[model samples]
Target: MQPFPSQPLDHDSLHEECGVFGVIGVPEAANFVALGLHALQHRGQEAGGIVAYDPERGFNGAHRFGYVRDNFTKASLMETLPGALAIGHVRYSTAGSKAPVIRDVQPFFGELAMGGCAIAHNGNITNAAALRRELIERGSIFASGSDTECIIHLMARSIQTSIPERMKDALRRVEGAFSVIAMTRTKLIGVRDPLGVRPLVLGTLHDGAHVLASETCALDIIGAEFLREIEPGEMVVISGGEVASVRPFAPAQSRFCIFEHVYFSRPDSIIGGRSVYETRRQIGVELAREAPVEADMVCPVPDSGTPAAIGYSQESGIPYAMGIIRNQYMGRTFIEPTEQIRDMGVRLKLNVNRALVKGKRVVLVDDSVVRGTTSRKIKDMIIAAGAAEVHFRIASPPTAWPCFYGVDTPHRDKLLAAQMSPEEMRDWIGVDSLSFISLDGLYRAVGEAQGRDGACPQYCDACFSGDYPIPPSDQIANGGFDPEGPTTLSDHTAP
Candidate 1:
């Protein structure tokens, strides 16, 4: 396995860690997992893996370094991982570098003292480095740089008698956000962190098989009925056609990642009982009420910003137009690892529509601005396309702080919002005007009408508010920079 390396900070956009999916009591379980992972492909694109458990075959695993459609869809690959219980992961590296090695791919399996188990995890472990050091001192051998691998090793060392008990023991020793799905020979398990920093939902298929996934969309893909969200600090174990709930951790105020409604989750998915697309549109409505702009048309940055822009246009009574067109074939540019490729910027993914933008005062609605690089490039493109004026409106508040949870955010110094005031950013991006939704407005958009409470906020807004629900132990200990500075840990784990 490759050693962990510091990745160069990419200022364009934030990335969520990964997505987990699991199913039990289903025939051809690996195939169902593949479909679930495909629905959640938006969460991670670099690598995908599935682990299945059969009484006869024991545990069979398949790990691939590419899109789920390209890897997990093939019948040959699915056939190789046959079983009645399965768990899968689509990975976006938050800890390690951009490497494509198989070892870094997930659904990491281990033969533990209790039983054989395979685990897939979403979210970052802020104390992974420290935990790794402690485990190493105890003679634990690691096969991958992934922090998820640390959980497997922790389980192996646990003195608990059952797999579920051992998992709880392992989780209690770690810190930061996590939504885990693990499978053993006869059971499947799912757990969310105390704060529910990342999302995990439970569903049931038509055949009465239980399903656990990062989002409701994953459940929708397989005609699964949305049962409910996995409660914070709760674990559900499925076996023998029965689902048992276990509360292994003390109750804490929930701090689900707010970015999920902003960009991480698929628009079709419902989070916190709110439609993700509707919430984004509501955010646009809130943005319009909070920061109205006079313009010929309201335009989105594309794909990510589309729903919010529509809401803005409707609320403002301004006509919405396709002022910017996106290249659907291109992957997200922010995930590009090398400076050379990322320096090319938004041009590879988006283009300004001269017909719609020329001679028009365009209002550009986007999810959020991180580095100002992409926004600056986009502003220039709009002006060049003959836009008389470019007004920038963001759905979320300025991202002034780094996220140590599942989201891949830049360090404090690298964040544009952290470094400059709104006016300064407007001048730097060369836009006529720029406005971000107020923190209260953001909360209102997400259905928290009273707005965020200073003492007990409704959701995790650390990226926007700097009020971290959990302390970043490793960062605090190491002076906030990884030992390896801006170096790729692996070749293909960029996002």
Candidate 2:
């Protein structure tokens, strides 16, 4: 089996599958869902959809191929989805075709034996291809090519009397990471995979409405009080402003994705009760301690790299400077579909501060480097702006393996770290020096005092360590991937 086709262009950064938001027992719940989706727009920007249920209107939904603010915020659209219970999804295609299809936009609804239910998911289903083949052989007619639709079809086949029960039966057969938010006429349900590989949080509104979202940032958008994260393998069914919890899977240790703290999550959000921003800064602290370099200034790649740069500067006793500035108004997808424009990609989004970086030995701190194309471009920009030397300090471990748990990573061959040594990468990118935080150092940053527990890792560092918590079943069956043969990150990779 070959690697998945590369994205349309080099989007240097990785993307999580989507973001989900659901609310029950709130007036104009669709409006609240829209607000939550707006806050979660960072997680996904390809498309958005909302499903709402009202006593008089039954179930109504609007799926559009664009941002939530561009689609779901319209008064006409929000009015059509009038209800006290609603669920929404902002999407970036990981399972289906990369091209945006309205049919593939989620908050997917299915009319079951008992009632109708809508589901929005934020993780990849590793065994989806196998599940789809089986379901097709068994006479299941599918609408969208999305792996998420497999869950719906599976639910349709379950011989259960209740929607929640059917969902449980269906999820029991699902493999890979999934944090699901589903809504029925009166009940809203949330569930996380056995490993908790993705995040799902529970919150409560002032009016006692219950909310389930992919991140705490979404909860904050609606002024909801953070309650707690839904436990791995746990399911919560909310109806009449009350939540009922259930554990349908066998007990297992939590292995939430470590990369959430690195790049996927918003800095202001919280994960495992730890502040994400603080953790990222601590990652920078660790990087400074582990890969110290004598430099005149510590400059962040901007936005994602800000906290880490601050930590590095503080630790190394170097002055912090905004050597590079990002265009907040420029969207990541601003490039035209032309080679000339693609060559000018990073320039459109970022620029070096000529005066600040001129004649300075700059240390560039960034979250992670995927293809290395952007890193090379940034380094050239710095040098052309008159920087004497440019060193790179990455906040996370090398992303050598492609993530199968929701994140849209490039194929292994496309990953710079996967194809070359750190020294080789340093030369290839034309940087003075390059270093990535060790896996253990990253664990320490996230509050693991002694570093990653190899015997039973507290977090899923599959992309960095290649130790996948859940086997990528479909890829394995198709041939090429080997879970047991992961390339271990050695301390030497950091020079």
Candidate 3:
């Protein structure tokens, strides 16, 4: 496997995997699915796709390389997908290259001996390369470069007489984080990996339709009543407006991604019945308590850092100020695929408020620092704007390891934390002082008051601690593990 080309700006942050949404028993299901995808646009912005099942048309799919609102909102486009059941995906390339063609945009549909199934997946398959090699050796032709296509091929070759059984068989052979929404001719299915590293939620429409989404924000957009989060190792098949649940794999302790509370989820989303915004604010409070500093004002790094900054201000008795303003029209810097565009960097989206920062000892709060590029640039911008001093407070621990599950993280060598100590980073970024929240404090912020349990941890902190819940088979097979890697995964395998 070729090493991904370095994008200096993007190396500083993590990118979320795709978002999946599906609905059954809803009239014009594509419309509702569209709204759900629109709400989940933050998860992935590279591409969007929808697949709908109509009795007359069988399976109709529309995959486009753009935003859902721009592609799926048109009457002509929505008219192309007519059905009572639909599944959709908003994608960011974590597996294959960043420049994906239309075919890679998913809701990947495959026809099997049992029936046609369309799947929208939100996570990585750790054993995908091995599985792909085995399937290819068995003469299974592939339609896309995505690791997700491996699941479809596995299901097609299954001897099971039903789609759900075939799906279970397929999932059993793979490893890593996965929250999938699939649609068959008669049923809509949702499944979470046994360890539940990724998130998936179930909801119900007032008219008796069942909905599955990667986040509750999607359900809120469509006015669906929140049901509950899909459990680890569980699969649900929705038919005739009723849901049938099954435990397809042996149960294991849940390992939800801790970073979701830090940056991935929308502020309004509720995960594990806890408000995401509240969790972030609590993280800020924890940071303030752990790393108190004297400053005239607390300023966030625009959007992702805003909630935590507010929390830090409240806890420290300092006033929160908007010393840097983000351009509402600009998208996230990490989403820009090309190195040329990313090199343009922080200036494209954020501008310092000279009036607020000038002559002020500002405390800059951000979620986390990856490669240090963004933080360094922001510090420079603050100094240029005449700030007296800048203190950097990170809401989460230093991100020292790469994520093998679903997040698009830089390789070990490129991560700033992997190479530098906290003091070194502070000197490099030219901040007066720098501090990150402790790992245990992060757990406490997410409601784990006892801190992370060593025997059975509550969340996945692989990016910080290198304690991956599942082995990264593909990465290991490719000899991608470095001796200098920041952290190590626990010796465990999914049951």
Scored by lDDT, the top model is 3
Tens-digit lDDT track for model 2 on 1-495?
A: 212323332367788879999999988999999999999999998899999999998999999887787887779878899889999999887533566678988989999989899999999998999999999999999899889999999999999989999999999999889999998888999999988989999999976699999999999978899999999999999998789999989887888899999988999999999999999999999999999999999999988999999999999999999999998877745747787775677787899999999999999999998888788889999999999999999998888999888898878888888988999889988999999999999999999999999887888887888877777789989875764466342221100
Q: Estimated TM-score per prediction? A: 0.93, 0.95, 0.95
Q: What is the lDDT ranking, best to worst?
A: 3, 2, 1
Off by over 4 Å in 2: 1-10, 95-98, 335-339, 487-495
Q: lDDT per residue, candidate 3, 383-404, as tens digits?
A: 9999999999998998988898
Model 1 over residues 3-54: C-alpha lDDT tens digits?
1122332336888879999999888899999999999999988789999988
Candidate 2 global CA lDDT score:
0.88
User: lDDT (CA) for every model shown?
Assistant: 0.86, 0.88, 0.89
For model 1, the stretches where C-alpha displacement exceeds 4 angstroms are 1-11, 95-98, 332-344, 481-495
TM-score of 2: 0.95
